[model samples]
Target: MKTAEEKKTRNTKHQKAVLELLKNATKALTADEIREKLADNINKTTVYRMLDRFVEAGKIHFVTGQNGKSFYALCKSCKEEPPKHIHNHLHFQCEICGKVECLPETLKVPQLDNYTIRETQLLLIGTCKRCMNSTN
Candidate 1:
């Protein structure tokens, strides 16, 4: 019988591979895209499970596109101590190519009376420069 720590560490290869994929990706990648880039023969379900674990661990963040597709990207502000992460930035989704990218700008959360905000996600949808240039 393996200890919980051993169990978590044992199945870390897949998680490490997925984290490397996200770290190298310039834009957010979907699970299918990640699977296509992985060297190992990993299944879609496994990829999704790994992604879910990463999200819980604050190693990555995800955005749902306007087309209903979810893309994952690394969370640079993730801290291992408290297992917390900050994702207070805007996400841009290209309408034409369906690609999602993180905006460099940060969002300001407004203060409300007697209201508490847990999490916020700002998604801006439009044609990306690549798509715009190609059309022009």
Candidate 2:
């Protein structure tokens, strides 16, 4: 087993890279994009592996696009030392530009007394105002 400091160090490195990539992104990105951003410093396989680990660790989260591609983004708000993206937030995908936008602090998922709720995936796809207005 690894020591606490070792784990922290690893997490710090992962979070650093994730935030750096997100800081420069206007929309969500796939593991390949992340690998491209990191260049030869890391490979595509390792980027995917790191993404999985970060998602599990709550440092990053996934959102699916209209094209069915999985993209990642940093949480708007995070808990724990490294911070985790809230899973209950809304994800909006613009059909025109293919931008994935997160609508957080909007709504808390509803719970039913008799319902055994596990998880939810909601994606609202449409042309954004910018796109729609541009057509006119």
Candidate 3:
């Protein structure tokens, strides 16, 4: 495990670029999409490492798409000190545009009688407002 100081030192320019891309994105992006948006100098392996680092730092989070592809996005309320990963909202995927985004509302997980809910991931599929508006 790397120390906090080491993690801080590992934040290179390429990592900053990757974070910038996700920060400006309106929706979550896949690994391939992130690599494609980055400079040619950064390779696939390096991109994955950077992503893992960011995830460990609680700077980003990912949700699995319908196709089982992981889409990464910036964490809205994650902490970097102890690294807290808390996502209480659901994910929305626009079927028409093929874009995946995190919804703004908070999700309420149901209470079960005996079942324990460790993790929850919900993906709602339908046409987004942009696609709906474009039709009329």
Q: Which segments of model 3 are wrong by more than 4 Å?
A: 1-11, 79-84, 109-119
Q: Which stretches of candidate 2 lie over 4 Å from their true place?
A: 1-15, 80-86, 112-119
Model 3, 65-101: lDDT tens per residue? 8788889999865443422245668899888888999
How far is 59's C-alpha from truth in model 1 (Å)?
0.8
Superior candidate under lDDT, 2 versus 3: 3
RMSD value for candidate 2: 5.0
In model 3, the worst 10-residue window by lDDT is 77-86
**Among all candidates shown, the one with the greatest TM-score:** 1
Winner on lDDT between 1 and 3 is 1
Global CA lDDT of candidate 1, please?
0.81
Instruction: Write model 1 residue lDDT over 1-136, tens digit each, in one string.
Output: 9899876774687788788889888999999999999887878898898888787777788888887878899987544422324477899998898889988888767768997654567789999999999999
* TM-score of every model versus the real structure: 0.81, 0.71, 0.76
Candidate 2 per-residue lDDT, tens place, 82-107, comes to: 33234776778888887787766445
Ranking by TM-score: 1, 3, 2
